[model samples]
Target: MSLCYCNSQKSFKDCCEPYIKGLKNAPTAEALMRSRYSAYATHQADYLVATTHLSQRALYPKEDILLWATSNQWQKLEVLKSTPTTVEFKAYYLDQNKIPQIHHEFSTFVQEEGIWYYVDGEYR
Candidate 1:
């Protein structure tokens, strides 16, 4: 089995697939963050949009999200820190021009009714 795109050292089916597939909810902010990274790697734009907080959904249209996800060659994810409501991480990828790039962000998340949704981030 292939390893998860999140570099979780576990098989995709075991690590993030269930969340991406909508079969399960991510239990923590960190888990949601890791699964979101995997969604980018797998080009699952719907998952990304669905997991975004509703108030911020308009800020990230599905088309834009799809383009961003498909334009990159996702490499790996490095989670720097995780708290109850935040996750700081670096996502490495090759951009459209095939240049290596890093998207670093300290992301915020909110849980409503036991479901975690991405709110926004402070890019660094």
Candidate 2:
């Protein structure tokens, strides 16, 4: 059983994969944030794009996203805070140079028609 990348103590299939694969929708902003981290870890650019708010899509051109997503070796993810529409998390990973790094961000999300979408984030 492949464990999920989001540090959720759940199988990939039982955790974020369902959201990434469109089999289900994330119920909260924190869930969406975790799933997005899982998408980045797994190099699922399409899922990342699909879960992004339409207005924010243009900021992340596919090539740039693919480049970043493919270059990282994701290690750990920790959610620091969450609200109805925002979540803060820290993700640890290795860069293309194999240097360890941390990504800490406060993310905003929105729900439209019962589907949650990532809006933007502020890096820490």
Candidate 3:
């Protein structure tokens, strides 16, 4: 079975694909963060953009995101702390130069009409 990009110990199809495919909405900020990490791994740039809060979408134009996502080899994701509308996490990956890297961030989320959206993140 292909494990999820978030390393959630579940198959990709059983984990993030549904969110990426628009089959369901992420239930919380942490869940949205996990699915977004998976979207990067799978090169689903559109899903990444679509899930972002509209006010924040300008920061992640699809072309730029596609370029970034395709350039890295995403390794795994760890959820450090999660609240009702925020999540702190670490995403591990290898850059194009093959250097190991970790993106640690405290992210905020907003939910509207029962759909969660990524708002912004602060690097740590």
What C-alpha lDDT values do all the predictions have? 0.98, 0.92, 0.93
Runs in model 2 with CA error above 4 Å? none
Top lDDT prediction, candidate number: 1
Model 1 lDDT tens row, 1-124: 9999998999999999999999999999999999999999999999999999999999999999999999999999999999999999999999999999999999999999999999999999
Judged by whole-model lDDT over C-alpha atoms, candidate 1 comes out at 0.98
Worst 10 residues of 3 by lDDT: 24-33
Q: For residues 63-83, what per-residue lDDT tens digits would candidate 2 score against the true structure? A: 788889998898999999999
Q: Per-residue lDDT of 45-78 in model 3, one digit per residue for the tens? A: 9999999999999988999999999999998898
Q: Model 1, which residues run further than 4 Å from truth? A: none
In order of appearance, the predictions have TM-scores of: 0.99, 0.96, 0.97
Candidate maximizing TM-score: 1
**Every model: Cα RMSD to truth:** 0.5, 0.8, 0.7
